[model samples]
Target chain A: MTVPDPRFSLNQWTTRHWPIPDLVSGCVARGVRGVGLWREPVAEYGLARTAKLMGDEGLTVTSLCRGGFFQEKDAIAENRRAIEEAAELGTPVLVLVSGGLPEGSRDIDAARARVAECLAELAPYAGSHNVQLAIEPLHPMYASDRCVVSTLGQALDLAAPHPPEQVGVVIDTYHLWWDTAAYDDIARAGAEDRLAVFQVADWVTPLPEGVLTGRGMLGDGCVELRRFREAVEATGYTGPIEVEIFNEELWAMPGPDALTLTLDRFAEHVV
Target chain B: MTVPDPRFSLNQWTTRHWPIPDLVSGCVARGVRGVGLWREPVAEYGLARTAKLMGDEGLTVTSLCRGGFFQEKDAIAENRRAIEEAAELGTPVLVLVSGGLPEGSRDIDAARARVAECLAELAPYAGSHNVQLAIEPLHPMYASDRCVVSTLGQALDLAAPHPPEQVGVVIDTYHLWWDTAAYDDIARAGAEDRLAVFQVADWVTPLPEGVLTGRGMLGDGCVELRRFREAVEATGYTGPIEVEIFNEELWAMPGPDALTLTLDRFAEHVV
Candidate 1:
């Protein structure tokens, strides 16, 4: 059988129940070479231990899940800790989910401005840590309580104030598939060198309660996965394609089983 | 008490359980001079009969609920009938919810293309009937199963090929409050004279199953309802402000009580 694409990386949230050690071993056993980690799991496993585990398994840390929630009271300090974690793990990218509007405030502009301010304070720290801060524009449905950055254009705008290597944007299919200008924005992201991470997750209907978990498995929904992958590749991005689905079913499966299935689907729909 | 604004129109779907007759009397009692209608109820109550009832009550039909669902096999014929109904009811606008991708299909581009083609066929007919086809871009959450058009910008682009008087866009606060580019698009719509209808409904979190009917009461959610009204007015749109909410709790209220509550909230949050 043909091997999985070397650039295919499994995001920790996809198989959330998978223990860190088993996840590493599962990737190695399946010939997977990269992983996108979450800060909580890394912290839980002990940052040093998680980094050593990846090294032992010959796995590269493709990215760290998130760092930006600028609306919080101590956003800078929290983000600094996240940046330190990414640096220690040797991950080049730190995904940012800019928080939603501040409580009881309808002033999205102010909240967005806060994100910019927090970024200014953290960009230098991230640059020094050698981690690229990847601002992820979530789906507009989350604009109220999750992330106010709701378009690739907005994400790129947020990243523009920083150095290309210092700040970038993530292209996640689940959050972006509905955008009519997504293709144009994707091209713009590539041209501006702001396309820091490429994430894959299909969007399914009847979005579950809270609209958080319930992402469709690869090829299970309407997203044109191959087209997105092709677009990112055309932009000269030779980086890991992180499968970051947050479905309950996928998390409930045995870690090895889920990895194997993901590899197969990745080969079929994404790579 | 101050009289309710004459431009405030109640969309039938907002108080869904209220029979058409009760809805009419309720509006007339409240001095509500206009009503937005849904095709199913109008048909169930007999279209011509409903039209006559509105005329007899001296209430105007502001707009018709929908026309486009182009993915269906009979979409063209179906939309033609809707245009005819709007004309018969003497309403100037027929809102269109461009249907989502075909079942089990991953071709959203094709679905969107179908909507444009359907419009190309129906726009002239609608114009001939003295009805403008107003494309309502549903929230992105419904991009897969409900409507492929997810942004006001996209709707405006689709309406661009037609005459402004023949084709226009619907500005729904619930669907668009989260968009960063919404204000600019509103100005563009006004400048282009394509802002055919203005709708208002507050957004609440933890969207109920299907994400269709969880709209918050006007003052119950975080949306800047008055700001949206001002924005639309700034666009020079002097059309009726249609309050179209879809919430189970609101529907369960007595018809007159719901109307009273809506008027109060409209004044408090949207005036």
Candidate 2:
């Protein structure tokens, strides 16, 4: 078998049921060098232990899953904690899924404003931790109950005020592939020096209920993965390309098998 | 109870199973003076017969359901026939749900280019029929398999190359609500005189599978219906505000009851 691409990083959520210890071993067995981790799992696995384990296994923590959700009452405090966690884990990036509109509220403008405010509050904290806050604009379907930030353009606009070292943007293929302005925005993101993380997942039809957890495996749907990768690379972004599929079927597979499948598809469709 | 808003026009798909005759009589009884027609039901009831019936009942045909599916091989010929049908039905507006990328195709740019080309070919014919083709951008979630046009800005851009009277854009709250630039685009649509139709359907979450038929009733979701209506009116658009919903629950309700609920909600939440 061909050697796995050096830039390949498996997002922990891709193998949702994979135990932390086994996942570390699986990555090591496959010669995978990086991992994108989630907060809940790391907290459950003990942050220091997870960090020590990754260090022992020689696996780099590419990023922490999320930090934004500004609509929540304690969002600022929560995000500060998340920033500290990222610092402890040795990840340079903390992905932010800025929360959706407040409950029963139609004032999306207000919710978006809150995200900016929260970001300003957290950017300095993140900067002190040496962690760049990567604002991830989710697909528009998640605009109501998930992230109000729904396009790369919006994310860049929101990140504009902060220093590039403290604030940046993620270019996730699944969420952004459908946007007409994505490529243009990708170039703008690069020009602005806001390219922080690059995640890959395909866009499949008949989105499941709640429109979450249905992200297609690499090459299983219609996203132009390689084109997206090339676009980011063209922008001079040589970051870890995290394979972040959130499909039920893929999650059910053995972690090693899933990683094997993802590695193969990554080579075929993304690299 | 307050009389139904004169501008409220129930779209046929809102009551999918309601027979044309029953729907027509129900509107008249409820004091609703306008309706948005679907080509399928109109054809099933005989287009000429339906037109004559609406004329006899003194109900104006607000707009024809759709005409553009540019990806289909026979799209041009089919749209030409649709223009004729709109003319026969005496509707001045034909809404276009531009189809998604051709099957298995990842070239969205090419698919979008195809839409522009098809519009150029059909605009003159629609103009001749005294029918304006309104480009209706579906929600971005539908960009893959239903409609590539997914924002009001994109719709207005597509309609820009043609005469405003022949080619216009639709403002559907459900599809455009999540867009940060929607209000600005609405103003642009007004200044350009390209606002052909104003449609309303609140956006509720946990979208069912296929994501096609889960549109929320007006006051039932987070959309600021009155703000959207006021924005459209600010554009100097004195056209019908078509209530176009596609929910399985709403469709299962008895026609008159569904119409009653819609009228009540439109008054409470929209006008």
Q: Evaluated with TM-score, which candidate comes out highest?
A: 2
**Candidate 2 structure quality by residue, lDDT tens digits, A1-271:** 6779999999999998998999999999999999999999999999999999999999999999889899999999999999999999999999999999888899999999999999989999999999999999999999999999999999999999999999999999999998999999999999999999999999998888878888999888889999999999999988899989889999889999999999999999998
Q: Where is the poorest 10-residue window by lDDT in model 1 chain B?
A: B204-213
Candidate 1 segments whose C-alpha is farther than 4 A from its true place:
none
lDDT of 1 by residue, B25-141 (tens): 999888899899999999999999999999999999999998888888999999999999999999999999998888889899899989899999999999999999999999999
- Per-residue C-alpha lDDT of model 1 across residues A154-174, encoded as one tens digit per residue: 998988989989999999999
Clash pairs, model 1 backbone? none
Superposed by TM-score, candidate 2 places the C-alpha of residue A153 at a distance from the truth, in angstroms, of 0.8
For residue B33, give model 2's deviation from the true position in Å. Answer: 0.6
| Among all candidates shown, the one with the greatest DockQ | 2
In order, what DockQ does each candidate have?
Answer: 0.82, 0.83
